[model samples]
Target: MSRRIPLPPPPPPAEIQSWPDREARLVDRALAMDELGRRLLGGRRLTLFLVWFVLLELGWSFVGVALTAFDHGQIDPITLMLVMFSTCVGLAILVPAVWMTVRGILRDRVARERLAQWAALDSHPATDARLRAPTLGLCWLLLSFAMCAVGLWISFAVPAGTSREDGGYGFVAYGMGIGLILWITGLVGLTKAVGHYRFAVRLTGRPGPRSASSGHPRPE
Candidate 1:
């Protein structure tokens, strides 16, 4: 006589499994942490760049004051032209250079966040590929600025022919010529860099994974 065997307790229901739910909770928590990290990093990066920018501006102001003292009232037409030309070039280059650097830094931060997201997923590709353009632009701008600064210094050092000569034309001409060339080269590089960044943004989408989404489960 076989005793009536009690059926084994039925497997837990889907909702009771707890694993998926727990996983979802963990994912939510990780995402939150990732967002916080991004915000912190972004703020720090911007602060650093801002400080650098202020320093650059201060140096430029000092140089302008010195130039004014040296050439006050007795400006050479040729030197004036060079100064005007260099000023134009500097303005043109500076706007985009700062823009590209800031943009690149932001992209880099996004890439880092993507990396953190990938760690949880089944597959995660590196975002470094997206950085190529911005990085290139940054390098080009830095090089161009350095070259221009050097040219300006050299212009000041050239011998003056007479007391009437402020050496402005010679200084301005050589400095502006070198600066213009560098600015043109930087612009070309900046264009290429921007294209690369756009392509990367299209591929990965801006603010990926960590993007704002209420559907994302809340962390436990």
Candidate 2:
């Protein structure tokens, strides 16, 4: 006896006709969705990051001042304890600040690339102004200036021979040390912040939908 083999039929004509267009549309939708998601998510994160930065800076300044005050009296156990606590907090804040600064700077670069991609795709112009300007960079610049000023003032205020034993200098020597450190760090921060700002401005062109003077977004 002879055996017969059956061949499977091809897909319907309608299925073939619809597949390519459907797939293309799906891809487009996915890409658009992804861009939107990233924009929204990035904006929220950036805002939160800035707020945390401001709070930390304020806290650090206060702690530093308090430590300087303690240094004037005596290097007692309590003073030592407070100094240690302040140092620990400063170190802790510094770790996260540095991490966030680097992260934000990298994210800014990524955002520039994203803008390029959008332009290439002829997507809608992003109305979110946060992406256009280096907000964190500006904050860093302002903070750096303030820190440098404070450091200079402290340095000038510290007299020679201010020692803990005589309770005359209180924390003058320590103040000078901290002041110098702050000044150096402030200069470094300013340089990096300026670089970031310039790069961001170049990438985004004119500041998006917002005007820089008023710090508010225009009607989109």
Candidate 3:
């Protein structure tokens, strides 16, 4: 299902702004959330994960081949070897990746809570637009899906239609791999963006004396 993402109010008018030193520092700390999002979604760790994911795919392919061989009554030493090899290889990579993914998600959930609170605040008008805008997330989501569709087409259609002599399968596999990586990355980005937006909307809706009314610049 599609979700309705809440946007922060438009960039407040630019004007001379002043705040207590402590509040300014808090605001700066809060603004650091933008840097955090960029690192999490568009940084080296994501690249590392993408590279690691290919091995997971390779392991799955081995398992699939083993199962196919067993189904075709090719049960022998080779089949036994494939099964044992796939099982060992799969667990070797799968366990650590799963653990890392779960740990990252839990930590991010807590960080997202903080981001939502900061986003809900009425910060000084001069704050960077990245904080208020979900454009980066949306771009990642759309690009990922588009690339994934392209990958699916390449994986199935190109290999099936092309003659073996043409050797299109290798290229197709490359495209498919990239698409899969982007799709996973996009899913993670979407989750972070949506979670933050929902919490921000809820926080903004609640009744309270916001810092804006206190006659000082908003706190981070």
Give the per-residue lDDT of model 2 (tens digit) for 98-134. 5665665565455444433332322223432333345
| Candidate 3 lDDT tens digits, 1-220 | 1352232222222243344564774465455556544544444535544554555565455444444444344467876887788767766765666566666666565545445444444543334344434565555456545545665565566556655454444444544544564456546655555554554344444554344333322222
Question: Which runs in model 2 stand beyond 4 Å of their true positions?
Answer: 1-43, 62-67, 70-73, 123-220
> Over the full model, what C-alpha lDDT does candidate 3 score relative to the true structure?
0.50
Q: Provide TM-scores for the models.
A: 0.29, 0.42, 0.55
Candidate 1: residue 173 lDDT (0-100)? 46
In angstroms, the error of model 2 at 72 is 1.2
Residues 64-156 of candidate 1 have per-residue lDDT tens digits of 433543455666877677666655655555565556556645654454444333332321124323333454445544554554555454445
Candidate number with greatest TM-score: 3
Please give me the total number of clashing residue pairs in predicted model 3: 0
Q: How much lDDT does each candidate structure score?
A: 0.42, 0.50, 0.50
Candidate with better TM-score, 1 vs 2: 2
Residue pair clashes in candidate 1? none
